[model samples]
Target: MAVRNADISVRRGEVIAITGQSGSGKSSLLYCLAGVLPVARGEVRFDGRVLGALDDEELSALRRERFGFVFQYGELLPELTVEENTALPLRLAGQRKGEALATAGAVLSRLGLGELRQRRPSQVSGGQSQRVAVARALVHQPAVVFADEPTGSLDSANATAVLEEFLTLARSQGTAVVLVTHDADVAGRADTHYRMRDGMLAPFTRDAS
Candidate 1:
């Protein structure tokens, strides 16, 4: 198979969906865009900067300062409470521990997770854990957020709830959201949808007739 290239320009406050079949390279594309994967033959850009131009240290800094991520599984630290887990990024960014914990509390409140702030990940439901994950992703107020199959493991109701929360929060906060998923219902909620096939991306359209 030939290597493929895809580019997307997302405005602040917009949500973009990336959809593709298995083996179509959606995950690889996301990694490249996020600067987590080295670009050997092509370039990825974000906010006018070429991702491939940054060294690993620079890229790590950029990722921490500008990007947030939500994965399919809620990767909360096993030993941390909800508040601590949500506050990790802020703490890493040098916020004072007290301030970071306070900020985390506020975000958790916004996500309806306030009551679970002291609970460990093992004590929460999957949906609650995912909401905590979302809080962690946004606590630093990143310019862009990338979610890879964020709701993939949830039941329909839980997935819908998570997607709705993500879209609402991102739009209200003017954060650009790029999500990769295989589900049409999830893709349908995006402002722009693209399908990855044969290593390239194309606009996704439905037959109106």
Candidate 2:
């Protein structure tokens, strides 16, 4: 999807949900803001620095050191154990193996997956896998997290469970989140909601509920 114009501000610890159908430019806007994709027009700024202005190294460093991402599928590495996967971002950032795994274990415990940390992605249920993904995204205590259709693959009960934990952890750590989903129930969980259609964005209201 081509995102022509998308402008929004996300404050510290804020949860912003953008609801749009597939091909409605939701992911485009998200990747643009996360600095994964460059905007064609206008600018995307994080902490007063224009993303486009940053050189490749600077951008790479910024993304590595400060940003986090979670996709619809949880995208856990099938080869890695849950603990290993959750500790990956920290590992990539050069933290010691023991320290990273310990931290990951703590996060997994908090999310009620302590025992399952040793299990591989293929061994866990869909919801548990997504929680592991959330654990990974929050393990680094990033400035912001970008989640795309985070609960889209789960049943309603599992979806609610994962969403609640995701929001609770992010808010407690003062980490802002930008969530893009097609589900209204999930969108309503956000502090602010926006509707995206044909690449246009608008505030959503209860009347539209």
Per-prediction count of colliding residue pairs? 0, 0
The superposed Cα distance between candidate 2 and the true structure at residue 147, in angstroms, equals 0.4
**In model 1, which regions exceed 4 Å deviation?**
1-3, 207-209
Regions of candidate 2 where Cα sits further than 4 Å from its true position: 206-209
Residues 22-104, candidate 1, lDDT per residue (tens digit)? 77888877877788877678778887788888788888889997899999998999999999999999988889999999999
Q: Write the per-residue lDDT of candidate 2 for residues 1-209, one digit (tens) a residue.
A: 78766779999999999987789898989999999998879999999999999999999988888988999999999999999999999999999999999999999999999999899999999999999999999999999999999999999999999999999999999999999999988888899999888898889877754
- TM-scores for all candidates? 0.95, 0.96
Index of the highest-lDDT prediction:
2
Instruction: Please report the TM-score between candidate 1 and the true structure.
Output: 0.95
Model 1: worst 10 consecutive residues (lDDT sum): 1-10
